[model samples]
Target: MLDKLAKAGDIIAADAVTRAIAKLSETPVPAGVHVEATEGGVLLSGRHLRRRMLGDPQLRNFGK
Candidate 1:
């Protein structure tokens, strides 16, 4: 019936949202950076030295 269809749709939507969130959390970030889930959303925090030689592009090159 229509009600059953609506319930199924809601479940699908919720599952899709969860999957999207998981994918987002899996994203790669700078070294030493950390990610934690919060009530509102994911929180990213970390520290890195800002030396002229140490740049974003160079960082990505590392470990590869």
Candidate 2:
């Protein structure tokens, strides 16, 4: 029972992470900024620093 619960918890966590990543990938990047998702992970590029700072309050300095 405990093992099953543990497995279920892991699945839920993984799903949440995947959903969050998809949400982030769908966000529109600022003009000149580009975003792409590959097996390696998300790739972000461009001069528009503001858009890159989305979802991370700690990185707000980049937005400024």
Candidate 3:
């Protein structure tokens, strides 16, 4: 029973990550930024972009 539950949880997590990657792929990114899909989640890379993005109130609330 515990094994079955663990498997189900893993499946759900994988599906969510897959869907998130798909959605992230559809979103537009700046010229220097790069988006890549990984086994755990998506990766975004750019020069000083993380700090700049989180500084903005609007973009910071994007997930919500």
Candidate 4:
């Protein structure tokens, strides 16, 4: 499902998924969930989220 969507090579669709994830993780995130997406070939990250005061461009893979 998600894998196919990601591998579809459609940046628009992939960005949609990334944005959705950003919206969903705004608080104490739900557990027992797995989010897997291959390297954003075209669409970078929209997570735009900061952790511990550091922003997105840090040396980290936020989704991991």
Best by TM-score: 2
* Candidate 4: C-alpha lDDT: 0.45
* RMSD of candidates 1 onward, in order: 6.3, 5.6, 2.8, 11.9
What are the clashing pairs of model 1? none
lDDT of 4 by residue, 1-64 (tens): 6987777768887788777666444423223323343454222333432342263233144344
Off by over 4 Å in 1: 38-40, 47-64
lDDT by residue for model 2 over 1-64, one digit each (tens)?
Answer: 6999999999998887677666666666556667676544566776655555765453343322
lDDT at position 38, candidate 3: 69
Runs of candidate 3 exceeding 4 Å displacement: 1-13, 55-64
Instruction: Give the winner by lDDT: 1 or 3.
Output: 3
Question: Candidate 2 — number of clashing residue pairs?
Answer: 0
Name the 10 consecutive residues with the lowest summed lDDT in model 2.
55-64
What is the lDDT for 27 in model 2? Answer: 68
Ranked candidates (TM-score, high to low): 2, 3, 1, 4
- Residue 3 of model 2 has an lDDT of 100
Per-residue CA lDDT of model 3 for 1-64, tens digit only, reads 6999999999998888789877875566666767776676667777887785777564354334
TM-score of 3: 0.57
- Model 3 RMSD in Å is 2.8
